[model samples]
Target: LRILCNYAFNYLNIHKIYCKTDNQYAARLYEKVGFSHEGTLHEHAFHYGKYIDKFVYGLLSRDYLKK
Candidate 1:
């Protein structure tokens, strides 16, 4: 994740990275890696037999560089 983010920010000149997930573990990982909650999509996906809420996360290039 660190390598990817750095490559994109430094070489590719990407501004930010976005991630979406319904699991707390994944969300926490994103946060640990410098992303912050951007928003949520209510009932964004249908799982087994119910709808699942998805969260959007974002990490800005400046913020990523700071880490």
Candidate 2:
């Protein structure tokens, strides 16, 4: 994740990056890497048989550079 962020911000010249996950641990992992908790999408993704809530995380170039 860090590598991707570095490349995105440094080489790709990305302004912002966002990701969504249905797992709580994954969301925390993103937060640990400087991503902010943007929002939660209620029942936004479908799994085996039902819809699940997805957590959104985002990081901006400025924020990534500060790390």
Candidate 3:
């Protein structure tokens, strides 16, 4: 994932990179790559007959460039 983010920021020349996950472990992993908790969509999805929360995470290209 870090490799992908690097390519997206460096080669693709994107302005921002984002990720959304319902799992806490995945969120922590994204945080390691400079993504931050941008927002959350409460109960936006359903799983196993129950509503699930969606977490949004993002990082800006300028921030990456500064690193």
The digit string of per-residue lDDT tens for model 1 on 1-67 reads 8789899999999998998899999999889888999999999999999999999999999999987
Clashes per candidate, residues 3 or more apart or on different chains: 0, 0, 0
Give model 2's TM-score versus the native structure.
0.92
lDDT tens digits by residue: candidate 3, 1-67: 8788889989999999888899999999989878889999999999999999999999999987787
The alpha-carbon RMSD values of the candidates against the true structure, listed in the order shown, are: 0.9, 0.8, 0.8
Per-model TM-score versus the true fold: 0.92, 0.92, 0.93
- lDDT of the candidates, in the order given: 0.93, 0.93, 0.90
Candidate 1, residue 38: the lDDT equals 96
Candidate 2 collision pairs: none
Q: 1 or 3, which is superior by lDDT? A: 1
